[model samples]
Target: MKSSNLLGYAMALIGASFFSLKAVLVKLAYLPSEGANVVLAQNELEPITLLALRMGFSVPAYILIGFWAWRKLADKPSFLPVVQAFALGILGYYLCALLDFTGLLYITAQLERILLFTYPIFVVIIGTMFFGGKITRWSVLAILLAYAGIGVIFAGGEIATGANVMLGSVLIIFTAFLFAMFQLFAKGLINQMGSWVFTCTAMTGAAVSILLHFTISASMGEGVAASLDLPPRVIFIGAAIAFFSTIIPSFLVNIAIDKIGSQTTAVLAMIGPITTIIAAIILLGEPFGWVDALGTAITISGIALYTFFERRSQPIRAIPLKT
Candidate 1:
């Protein structure tokens, strides 16, 4: 590999690592004072409220990124793309994130990561359903293998011992599906509006949606007061999440895709689950079983195999960058 490709690989690894750490960080924030953290929140934050706070810290960065991304353009993109991006932002980030965080209330961080990582499989299924894309032999086998792995993890992992395991799994699976849809939505826009600009715009839209959601929740009842009653420690954890998981990894992964193309990037993304599992084990004391190990390995193998052969079957072409 060239030095540049090496750099891209490093960036991808770093991005994957940080993204994996998101589950750990969120778990920390979710934990009660007795479980961890030096300080307790004045009011325990609800999932939606916590999400709103996260978006609060994140939106300014998105605004700056949008301006920087479009600064050099002579003729800026039109209003329609902006509107589309905002809508997608609400759909993808706002909805999916809310579902994800709520699901985490019932699931372990490791399981959350595993389920979220299945978005690629959801992507293939969704594309086949909606876009009339054909399901390949490899895809069929990959799906079976992936589900088998999921079954093993579900049956054997300690996380699955929770009373609400089924509900949590279902919620995370739905979140994964939404994320897959998000990717599909971004496909066209990323090609036309540029990844940086579109991502920033979409995220800004998500911020707006979050603010609206919080406003409504606050008006409805007690959640808003609880949200505002968050302590400095909780606020710091939210800020860390915004910066580490949301902002930094987004750019790093996007840049990695730009540098090394999507195929390699897809394979590198497998690192995320492994990183998450380890982080959960060490940080959250989540149980890592033999079944978890074997299942995760099988899952990643299926994903890597699908990425390889799928890319092989597609026409060799460079992805176009907008602007």
Candidate 2:
């Protein structure tokens, strides 16, 4: 690979790694509600409330950053793409987050994450369907291998018996599809808009969606009342998550995807689940079993093989290969 392509791969991998770490962080941030001792357990955090708070704080920051980027533009910006970007952001990231977070209330983190990782497959399928692109044989093989690997990891674990778990699993899978749509929309819009402007608009859209949800939920008495009752460190942690998991990694991945391609990015995306499993073990003290380790290795190997063989069969050029 050329040095530039190598750099793009490295950036994409880093972004994916950060994205993986988010699973661990989200699990850590999620605290089981204990009526009396909730404060002491799991760092006194509430996932939904913290999520609302994080988006609330991020709005101004995104606006500021977006403005900074807008000022640097040489031509006048069009409003339509910005609006489209905002919609994608709200529908894709924010709504999916709502489903994922709510689903977390009913499911295990590992299961939630594995289901979310199904997005790469959806992305490939949707891109082919809507964009008139063809899916290669290797992509099919990778999907099978990845799903099998997930099964291997959870082989001995009891299937969640509750209806909530089943429902949550379905929501997580749907959320993955939503996220896939989000990426596809972002990719299309980003071609015409700067990454910063497009992202900021979409983030603003997500922020608005979260705020509206919080307001409606609060009116219905479903809102988190004590979200701000915690010490300031919790707020800091939330911001750190927004910045690291959302902002920085997104910036990195967008540029990298533009430099390379989403398929390349997706192949490297396996790094996310691997990092999440490891981070779960290290930070959350979640057990690391032989099954988990072996499954992760198999999944990564499958992804790599798919990407390698596919890339080898196709010709490389200065332009990116379409996803």
Best by lDDT: 1
C-alpha displacement of 124 in model 1, angstroms? 1.1
Tens digits of per-residue lDDT, candidate 1, 1-323, equal 69989989998888888878877888888876654434455225577777777888989998998899989656678889889998999988899988888888888888888777777777788888886566789888878887888888877766566888789889989988888888777888878788889889999999999888898988788656654676566678889888888888888888998899877876787788889888898989999888888888887777777777778776222121110
Least accurate 10 contiguous residues by lDDT in model 2: 314-323
CA RMSD of each candidate after superposition: 3.6, 4.5
Identify the runs in model 1 with alpha carbons over 4 angstroms from their true place: 34-44, 223-226, 315-323
For candidate 2, lDDT tens digit of each residue in 163-182? 57678788888888778777
Any idea what lDDT model 1 has?
A: 0.79
Q: How many backbone clashes does candidate 2 have?
A: 0
Q: Candidate 2 at 47: error in angstroms?
A: 4.3
- Report how far residue 205 has shifted in candidate 2, in Å: 0.5
Total backbone collisions for each predicted model: 0, 0
